[model samples]
Target: MSELASGVQVVRGEMQPWSDQATPHPALAALLTDVVPANRRTLILGPHAPQQIESVLAHSADVTILVRSVADAQQLGEDFGPCLQVIAGALDGLQGEPYDVIIATDGLDRVLGYDSSDLSWTERLGALAGLAAPDAVVVLALENEFSLLNLLDSRPADERHGDDEWRPLHDDPTRPVSVDQLKAALPWRAEVYADFGSRTFVRADVAAAARPGELPTRLATAALESVDVPLLSPAAEGVDSACRAGLLGSIPTGWVAIAGAGATRDVYTQTGEAVLTADQNLTGWDVTITGDATPAFDPAVVPTTVPSGVSVETVLFRLAAAEDVPAFRKLAADLGEWATTSRVILRWDDVIFDGESFAYGVSPWVTEEPVDKEDLLAAAWSRFQDRLIGQHRRHPWPPWMLGDDLVSAWLGMSGIEPPEQLQATSPDTAPAAAVQVARGKELAAALGVLLETRTDTVDVRTALAEAEEAKQELFELKGHVYGLERTLGFRNKAMKTRENRIRELRGQLQRLTTAHERIRGSRTYAVSRVIFHAAQVRKPKTVARKVARRIRKR
Candidate 1:
């Protein structure tokens, strides 16, 4: 092993220079806060988020991080203070004393180097266990092969394959596949967590998961919203189905096992800037929201306990789908009344109705500024409109009415006047109203893009093919029309020629008839006619016959 100037140690020939492709989740950092002790010998394995590394550093003075990438090791050494010991090599090559805490939250798959032999999952876990002290607290994450995310992915197997799968040992017979199997395979007693996106987890096994509107269902739903990948179908409906069957834990995207007790909450979720946790109490559930950043919304405005009822968003969706316009309008009125009376920032999905009264759902956000009643109503309805249209959800409204027009109509239904634009109570807040409108439209368009699945793919391709066929037909028709026009032009010239010939013949006949009339009117023709008539009286038949023959000859 050679040491660099940055104090990063390198076990030459085993270093990986490629990025490990690990995503850092704040929920993981929060979990580390609960389990990782202060001032203890700690070892972090694989490529972890910088946030996670910082959390570890804050807890332990003697911290050693093992990464297969040399560049990452050097970077970590430079970014962190001299107190951190960075090792660049495969896990097998590292020579280290047993650590009090071993964190492999990124999982054991990425710790191997380019030169390292293929290691099975069980063998990797054993290696980690060997490096841990007898009473060491170990936090390890295991990716589930049967995750809902994987099931919902519409891409073909070949398309889904990534560089990380080059040496994946998914066929290892000794590897654990389920949470129970994972717990049984562990050398020490471990508390297993169902990790969804590494942002929401069922930290403890709770019986209330089967009940709708509970922590488990809520966590799964929240995870659906956090998915960054396109899915074949809405995973929310699948998750809901799983929740109904009490099989949510069975289909976790991954499992996070803590070999020692660190997390006490029943469910843990991280939203934008805050972490929301739920702990079961005797009456119902206790929910709390905490964050490091100054909150934009008042924490007091949020509920201290879990609210029990159906989500307002779910009800709205159902009502809209059923085409129950009156019911939807009534619900909108109820929501408007609640917002106006409470004057708290509300998310449609984060509010619950218990048949009579509305309660705040467990959410990481709270709106800080008090909004005008009309604006509040407009914002909620506008967002609901976007979600409905974006998700390709069915509604009672006409097809021609959409986007802002639909939002305006919903606002009017909610008893807001002059719904063409958001009526900001103050001139200073006018910009916020405009921003809200833009944001709603942007979100709708984004959702439409993100949620486009194989259904859309097939539909679009079919439509395009039909369109192309129609275009070709139109081209052929245009060609036929041009040919017909050319033929008509030739016929018109022939008809004009025939008309000119007829006109010329009629003019010649008119001149001949005028000459005959002039001859009959002349005096010489009259005297000749009188003499012919007197001769005809003596030789009547012969003269008349001869005269008629002469006239015919002339």
Candidate 2:
């Protein structure tokens, strides 16, 4: 793959390979040698042979190498060493930048481990395409054998295996993905590179060829000429695989008309006349006509002539959805040339009978209401601020009043009496209210000098000072709470330590009680207790002899 950069317009080449091949594919070599212009940057991805990279690097010192790791770069040697850059992880890291050309050999299939779903492959390939500049090229080298073989292998056996006997086969390391599978996963145009062994390559220009109904006759001819195989260029038969496979429908042509009572029949007729006169190719075929009023319009009024060499089949019908005036207007707009060519007239009998005239040919006339400059100004002024005194008292006043004199005059007009304490309150509250009013008036004026100005700075400053004082009080309260939290932190730590010590003591006491109970139940403890009582009795021997003598006397 290759592309020419902006400034110097130099072409660059790129090649990707999975296996350690000494020689790149002949088709790839040819593309690199032929397509790449001189003095531009080139990039190569995957674990390609060092010699192959060296060959391209010798031709252009601006070559860059993207590998899986630092070790891979080191192994590639001096030719690729300086230009080598590790991709870090997945292809996601390479997004967000433009590349002149991207060449993915087997890397697209090999980079992501074997996944049953084709989502990762599709997404990565799309990202690769996005990374390229508009005119840049993307080349994918795929193996056809791997794909065909895999397809054959995936077929079910004659007899299904029992649950105990079921087993899955390991993917062969030599083959990562099939060409057909990768092509199916891509969004752009692709074709198999039959000349280059099992490799398949897709160019960006080829992929984006032409959109639906946008193909030029010349390009369409070229596309058809290029198709030499079935399923490769299905567009040769006026159907791409996407359409043949039922993924998309053929481009729609013909005409549909929508007209209603409120629709602009004159505009529609004029537009249709313009299209018929302008386009030459749309001559004789029956123009499908539909619509409640469309069929009623005389076809003789519709312009039949067209410019030379233009061919189009006309199908005119009124769509149910286009019954409303707005819907009809939108449909006409979307129809573009068709709406311009086919005259579909709509009539408003009620409006005509009433003799009502629209200001403009279209709906929503600008001159519907008479303009009153004085009322407009008055309305605008009222929204700004309501003056509380003089003629302008309670009158809408803008934020930035014109001037003090103007304010006085407005006050007179509004019948508002200036406050007696105006001078006294001027410092504390007047400026603030004046500023608020002034700001609104200033915005309303928007560069137009409207509304009266008033000076109340002194009163406003006093009010601001009072607000500042209150704010300071609140700040002090917050500081006090912060101090309380600090004190609590120290107390909390002390309590925690005391609680832990108490817990430890309780555990030790419980262990001691358990040990004492075990000792009490042991045979050794019982014997020791009996011996101690016997010793005490021996000590009482004297007392016992006395007791025996007393018994004999009895």
Which of the numbered candidates is closest to the native, going by highest lDDT? 1
**Per-residue lDDT tens digits of candidate 2, residues 384-455?**
222222112222335355454343433334333333444454456664334433533433343122111222
TM-score of each: 0.72, 0.26
Off by over 4 Å in 1: 1-5, 11-13, 164-167, 204-216, 292-300, 322-326, 341-345, 362-369, 396-401, 404-409, 417-554
Q: TM-score of the candidate numbered 1?
A: 0.72
lDDT of 1 by residue, 1-554 (tens): 88888888887334554656667788788888888988889999988988899889888999999888888888888888687888888887877679999999988877887777788888888889889999999999988888887887767766776875444555778878787899999999998888887878775366225445555676666675566656766666677677778788877789889986554677777765567777777755687778654334345555788756667877888888899999998987777666663345445666777778777776433344455666555656666775566556789889889866787677666665562555678867644434545544543343333323122332233356568989999999999999999999999999999999999999999999999999999999999998987866866788779999999999
User: lDDT values of the candidates?
Assistant: 0.74, 0.35
After the best TM-score superposition of candidate 2, give how far the Cα of residue 254 lies from its true spot, in angstroms.
41
- Each model's total of backbone clashes: 0, 59
**10 residues in a row with least lDDT, candidate 1:** 451-460
